[model samples]
Target: MRTAVELSWRLLRGGGRRSMVGSLLTLAAVAVSTGLLLFAVGANHAFLQRAHADAWRHPGDSVANPTAIEALSTDYVQGEPVTIIDLAALNGDAPVPPGMSRFPEPGEVWTSPALAHLMKDLPADQLAKRFPSPSGTLGRDALVHPGELVAVIGRTAGDPATTARRDVVEHLGATGGPSRIDRFETDASWSADVYLLLAGLASVLMVVPLLVFGGAAARLTVARRDSRLAALRLVGATPGQVVAITTAEAVLTAAAGALAGLVLYAASVPLLTHITIAGGGWFAGDLWPGPPLLAGVLAAVPLLVGASAVIGLRRVVVSPLGVARRETPPGMRAVRILALAAVVIAFGVAGGGLIDMGRAGMIVLMVFLVLAFLAINFAGPWVVALIGRLTAATARRPARLLAGRRLVDDPRSAWRTVAGVALTGFVAGFLALLNAGPSSGGPPDELRVAVPYERSAAVAGQAEKRLAGIDANVSVKRTETRDDPLDADGPVTTTGVVTVTAPGGTAAVDRARTALTGLVPGKVVTTGADEDVTGDRLLADLRTGALTVLVVSFLIAITSAGITSASAVLDRRQAYAMLRLAGTPLSVLDRARRQETLIPLVVMGGGSLLTGLFFGLPFAQGFGFSGLIGLAAFVVLGFGGILGAGALSRPLLRSVTADPAPRPD
Candidate 1:
């Protein structure tokens, strides 16, 4: 073992420029994979933390001998959601909330830092007047994210704001009315759950591609490594010694790369904090994956690299003579294609609602989607080989002929070059078709407030009186239901909606809402535009997350293409040298390399994109103009990115083919 380790170190350090370049490429690949994996894991953790931070607003359970009463309402200021928590203590023993040092006194208000800033910027009547001057700021533990706007107002036990008569149930078990509670913690809201699901989905999308890229790192310069290892076997080195040497080399390199990846993740934290999700940007600590997770990833990456390296050694280990003679391995089997087809069909059935899987149906569908995604990987090399055979059969140009033969020679290597973009194309297609279109809302200037059905006339009179100074001609009418998309319970049927329309513009709407703030007790005074705010925000968030996923995917795709293309040049250096000596032009060689990547890219990328669209069809209501535009844009960008990555390796190809001297291995 000691001798094997020493031999491995000597081989790694003493290998010439080509070997050094190969090692660097592998290190870079592992580093990128490790950093991205950490980011994906961190993002999931951040969403959960955000959910936990805001869970207190949900009010866990109602106690018979409660110490406090809590009422939750939402307010809109400049088109942003501001969660308002109205609280009153029934006894001195009432527990303080997450961010507060002690229970607030009556008339005291606590605001998040974001809300404090917004209050200072807006007019007193427009926003600040809605609450008394903030007496304290809510801490991070009490806020979902750094930019979230939340206000906790302390009220007297009998205050109308906390004791309003709510006829509708907001969530499943709790009425919209204030609830008695002995504690502040509870399960996350439905919105939090939605965010968590999206975050998890995004992680799955990213981590898989990163894993593929990481595995490809082990195969970089495989031709050179195999020849070297084969020579060791022929020199009477046992298979165990050969495995020890390979493991030692791969583990050391992967460990260094993993550490470098941690550094990269740390450096990216400041930039990641700027991305807004769930109505606010992240806190620095929110993006931290913690010490245990970080350690696990560090260990996992090197082990994965080591395992991949060993797995690729079968040919050299089984028959060193065959490797030395440069025999081509058997072609990939059709079973790879079968596995992919099976997964796709299963996904379609599960997602299309063909089977009644109950509440776990969505979970089952997501699992199939992931399987289909991984299956694309399994099928890619076979598709490449098939494309190669056709190209070799029909190619008219030397470049095309060379490209075909290369693909047939090693389909796995060809597949790795375009796998990242192929997966990215799938993500782009899935997200594009899932976009929600613009929602039609009520008249922009109207302010709608839900009031008790019995007191409709009295509330209308009070509303008119409150807005008398703002607009005397303000029309007020009572309706049967509240049309608020943000309301989790859907349209409130039991309550009466008091529609208030003023002659003036948005200013009048804001003033009307302010005037009717507590006129209907616990109910929120929302505008006609507010009817679509929830849907609009959800759509906007979806687009943002989709854009984020596309960007990250493209980065990985481009990086994988560029790195693997360069490594491929290193792997085939001797072949290129011999071809050049035989009078083949460098231009032909470069063109062949580009065609090798482009052919499979066109075939596999299109397949994955179509599969993504197929999976998304069940959820898509219709193809929106924006979705079409996004699809077209990504298609153009994906092809353009692959071309650019291919172009980057042109110089490497030229350099490798610069010398045509025959050298002994």
Candidate 2:
């Protein structure tokens, strides 16, 4: 145990700055991923809570009137007459109460504080209006008359059988006061949905990279120490001890990193609350790293490292020293079959769930990716053989022949580089395309329109007449909407968007809208693309948020791919040296790496494409995104993979050529 501890400390310090940097870099990646996941999760939880609260605070659920404001009466007095005031007159033509004054103007309506707040700008005092009665109207069905001075109150839901809470009524002013309105509820879902989506995506994104990078680290660290381990074996150390020593060291380091991360995550949760994007609300609570989550983190760290060490050690244990000198290649056939199965299952589940498409397409896509990866991994020799044959004609072509032969000779080494490059190139290009796309040039136009959703036909006609009068040459599009009583405490409006082109810039469109709005102030509200609150814009924002998550995951995957490929190639220095001695040139070596790595790169890229297609095609039926967006993603993925491979190759080549590197005879 002491020896193992001593050895671990020695190894930990051996890499000096490189090891520290590597560990720190790994930690940073993990920390960022974990932190984001926690923040997103917390934000989501808080948002959902607030949504439920807001829903409870409104009273439209039980009320028969769905609208924020209900107009009770609009009666005419004797020819040039005015509305009279009477509490009972709400039901009929009752005379005004003995002493109260009646409003004598048109467009006057009585309303509660909430409703009045929304219409503060309206001349309610001069126009007849009723406020909620002071005692509350819970069971009464009576309405208010012109001069009746009835009160209107805000209602909040409580226990089913109990009296619901009501707020004091107030008259309308130019800047209305607060009343619980139902319209706010419409966009409330977004408050919670954003956090939930972010949290879920962040969690998923972290998992893959942790697995890939952790596995690579363990594999590289253990393999690099095998010579020392073998010497310990000669000194009579048992295999169990070898396993224990190596595994213990790894677990210790991993635990240290995990603890560091946990501490950092806990510390930063407060700051994270304010870090919101896309209208995603703040994180509202302390991060609770409960037993299960903490256990997962602690367990995952050690398990990842330990598993890699065990896998590597098992091979060493099974092989005799003489035979060990000649490393046995991993079987290509086995890996291909396994990877195929994995790819199929994952894609099948994901694709089916995403598109309401049966699980079969998803299954096939997943299976293909897994199979493709396995084939590259296990059937390295077979792939090399195929590539070798394909380029066999170039055997006499010097660099080309050398590249082909080298790839065929040891496909595993060759393909790792390929995978790295492909990942880098694809990511880089995908980002470029996003920036290059016209849609990404600026924020999407904000859609705004006026109210009267049901009366849109009449409203649109009025708008068109007004527009024509102003020489706007505009077209009016009618739309339907459910009122959001909360937004303005009245009937709100919704509409499908309309495009307007009036021989001038957007400014001209605005001017035209202003001219029309001036003509018909209350009868017609804009319900098309000219309104301030367009549902489509919100929907688009949500879609953009989802896309952002996908892009971030892709980037994390690229970084992970680089680490895995570099570590894998670096661990097999002896094998590469042997290949070099056998006269493999740099070009052939690079080709083999590209082939192996590209298999997975292409598979993942294809999988992403299919995933997008599943969503985009159906969505396009309603709203379209350009096909070039997806195509660009694929191209970027390919280039990223290539670049990553090339970058990792330098250290790989150096490692391969370093001597006295052990020779695999």
Candidate 3:
């Protein structure tokens, strides 16, 4: 074991340019992997901490304000939706909301940063009309509007207790559902844990692409290492000893890489502290992983790396004859299609039940996503081989023919170079669905209506009675909106919105609301036209998701492309050098590399989209043809990205072409 360790160390320290380049690649992989893993951990931790802080900010079981609460939700704040929390308790009884330093006194209302931006120069009274008055319009102090920030207001102007109580009882408590004490005395309906889980999910998604890059960097030179080990075996080393030597080398390299990664992670943390997440950026202390966790991660990565190395070498037993000549891998088989088919079928079955999906359903869907990802990976090489055969059969040029044969020769390695973009494209299909949310023919027959939380139940009855007097034929289709906080552990605001859909057009909505205007109290936004509101929302989500994918996948692509180009050239230098001697042009070789990346990119990227659609379309029946547009856009972006990655090998190809042919011997 000592001898094996020493030999491994010596090889690591001095194996010529290939080893030097491979070491750098391996180090880069470890650093990136460590950085990504740590980032995920930090991000997850930060999200939870922020949530917990929010929960603790107003840690009461229920609200205890004396004045009646009239809560409503609206999209009036900075184009992002916000809950307009109205609390009109007498004097000292009005409690502060979370994340705020203090509660606003009688006439003053605290506004969220978003809301404050909109409050510019409006007179106090005009501002009050847009937002709620603290107690009611009677005993008013100077009109003080905090502007466009998220707001907390009294129900009426700064009225005394007697006036405030009468107003609260008159407006929110007309139906007498629950006493004021009963409202704030009970625990909030939802749990904060849900948000944490969501944060974890985001982290998991982010980490997947990072690992893909790291793994590609770490493993690109495996073939050369195997050849070296084969030579060792030719001398007399047993397979077990060879394994020990290789494992030690991997551990040593991985450990150094892990250490370098830790340093990179530490350096990047300050940068993370500046990027806002969940309404606020994290502090350095907030994102720091504890020593034990850091140590554990550092310890675990090497062992995993070592194990993977051993697994990779399973079929690589060294022999004198094998050392002299490499073995040919098996051909792509038709059986590979079953792997993709199984995932698609499983996704379809799961998605069939994913409508209005509950927590369990979401979990099942996420599991299916993971399964689909693995299946795509497993099927990738086979699909590449298929494309290769097709390409080789139809190719009319030497470059195209060479590229096609290369993919057929080593489809798995080729697949690795472009898989990140493929996976990212898979995610784009779902984004397409988001961008094309539930399409109902004309301007989505939905009206978003806000009402006071206290007499919320009464709004329906009142609307019915009033609408009956005007037109009984006008039906209201309402969707119940539960006031789940924006995220788990987010502040609890009782404000909610109910969607009232009138399929009978804008005129029907006017007719229906004309009667309810006298009875149902609160704000109603017209949604039958100017439907970009939904587009704005879905587009925002899409942009955010796309940005994350683009950054991570691009990183993976560049890293993998660089490493793969070097590794490929190293593997075929003798042949390439001879071809150079025989007068093959550099441009032809360059085109070959371009085709190698472009062909699989088109194939794998399309396959990813198809797989994503196979599952997504089942859930996207509510989405219209616009979803197709999103899918098209995603495929185009992926194709552009892969081409960009292929272009990265230009310098390497130039250098390879420049080298003179070696002696034929």
Candidate 4:
């Protein structure tokens, strides 16, 4: 056992550049996978924490109305009733006062501190005249006024009882404006944010399977080293001992990978933070760092290492016969189906959630994702047949015949490669879809009318009138911004615009431009204060998230696929030699190799891609699937690239074949 372990170590450490290359590739996969998972999980946690803080503190100090009035500037007549929250909602165990509405109306109240500052500009006796006192104060005075920025309620301004709602007040600061006359009491759902954290982690964790299982291809090197392992077996090495030694090597390799991954993860975090912080539209809160986050990092190491070791041992056996002959894993079809089934269950769960919740956009996205994944695996035969027929139609003569024959020659390998290419395609397609979808709702068309903000009632009205003048068929969709806050520079105002139906030829309406007209001086500005911007950083994380997964997993797959296919070809060297001696052309033999590899490559790649899309759909829809057609186009291109790679045959028998000329013995 000691001897075998020593031999394994020596071989691992001493082998030339090829050995080093293989080891590095293995290490790279582990590092990338681990690092990605860590970054994604960490960033998600950090982002969520920041989101909560930002929403509670500075900007979320006021209320936004999505439906009733778009902006306070538009709603504020020269004289109208106003409400200001005197103090923020207090958390206490003591009994509360009654008769005061649990929430307050916008422009109907003011905080004493805020009023004191504003009253700095007015005489003390005149302060009460300009701003009347409200009925109740949690502990302080509520000042009622007309069209003035006063007490900021941190809850929705539409609610009547939030005399001091924290959410309304924070929103008031965010919008850069005065508090409004009407704000609704509402809570933002954080489900999507939670899902982002979990989903991003899962996405990163998926790399584990690819790295562990994919590295199984390297076990072919063990086959080459069979005589060495057998020699140890002959000497006092037990089967268990041999297995232990091999597994230990796998452990060492994976450990190195995990460590590297951790280092990469830790090192990159600050940089990621910098980028996110600099962008700073909304996520301007302190980073999340605590025991839970540290625990998450620690947990990933053993999980990755143990998984890798298990996969390595699955490649070789404890017995001496393990190294004697090449053995393909058993019941591939059932295994593939089982794997597919698990993915299907995941998709069903996600889709079912979306459906039950009546989230139409999410449901639609998930449905397409499910279809894209299933298309790669179950549709392999059909895909081959279709491609074969298509290629046959373009065949000049012999090339066409060869292309058609490839469908039957090694369909599985061909499809695996195709599946891989398709995964990349699906992501691209999904992005394209997003671009095409409505910026806010339904879909964009000529005369698309939308309320940019729910509270911007005055602006919405003005925009509607402008659109009405253009054409009657113009659409006007009003959305509530009761939860959105105005900027600090302006009065709390809701801003939404109506889409005008041009006479078949006109420019699309600029939402920001329309918002500019109704703002109070030094106050409301267009564009900048939407919930979407608050969530933008999370989406940016996705851009690299997908690429990281793709690159690492694809590399693992490629390495594993190449090694396994090469070894399989080597085991069949005698067969190839005999065929060459016979009348079979070298080209046919080469074609056969390509067929064998291409099938599985297509299958695995395509199936994984389809699975990704299926799982990704509900999430995509939640985000809004707008550029679906573009996503499809990207998928098609990815498929073509994979197919092309699979079809190109390597110089077969170059190393395997012996020279015809005799060598001196």
Q: How accurate is candidate 2 locally (lDDT)?
A: 0.42
Model 1, 288-316: lDDT tens per residue?
Answer: 88789889999999999999999999999
How would you encode candidate 2's per-residue C-alpha lDDT over 1-665 as one tens digit per residue? 88877876676667554354444444444444444444344444454543443222122233332223211111111101111111211222222211224321122333423223423443432122322223322111111111212232222222111131221221110011122232323233332343444344333333443344455455543345565566566568788787877777666666665666567667866665553343233323423444575576567766777676667676555553623354544545545545544654554555434535434443443344334333323433454456555664556555556555545555544443343233323223222222211222221122133343455456556556655644343334556454664566566356533323444444344444344432322121232332222233345444454455445445545655565456555555566677777777766666655554554345544544443343233224332253355456546755564566457656656655655345431
Clashes of each: 0, 78, 19, 133
lDDT of each: 0.83, 0.42, 0.58, 0.42
Q: Which candidate comes out best when scored by lDDT?
A: 1
Candidate 1 least-lDDT 10 residues: 167-176
Candidate that scores best on TM-score: 1
lDDT of 4 by residue, 1-665 (tens): 56655866787798664455455555655566567556545555654554342222121223343222222211111111122322222222211212134543434443434344544554433234333353333222111111123443333423333221222222322232232323322222243334444344434334333433333423433333454455566577766776666666655666677778778766765555444231232221223346676566545554555454444443344544544443333322434455457656755755646645644644454444445445444555455555555555565655345545554443443443343344444344334312212234222223232344553455545555644433324334554454436545444445455544334221222222232232322132222212233244345444444444444444434434444444444434455566666655766666655644454445444455455555555445443343443344344444444434434324335444444232211
Q: How would you encode candidate 3's per-residue C-alpha lDDT over 1-665 as one tens digit per residue? A: 89989999999878876566667777777777777777777766665555544332121222454444334333232223343444455455555444445554455566554344444543332232454333322110111111223455544433332122111221211111112321232221123344455555455455665655555555657777777777777778898898899789888888998898889888988787765433335557657777787887788777767776776675567343553475556787766779779778767666887756767766776677777777777788899988888899999999999899888877877887777778766766654554434323234445454555655556666655655644333223434444564666555545434445555544455454434432433343435332344334334444454455446554555555556666666655555677778888878877887788788887788778767666667555345455565566566666666566556656755665676668321
Misplaced by over 4 Å in model 1 are: 165-177, 354-359, 452-454, 480-496
Candidate 3 residue-wise lDDT at 606: 78
TM-score of each: 0.94, 0.54, 0.67, 0.52
Model 3: ten consecutive residues of lowest lDDT: 138-147
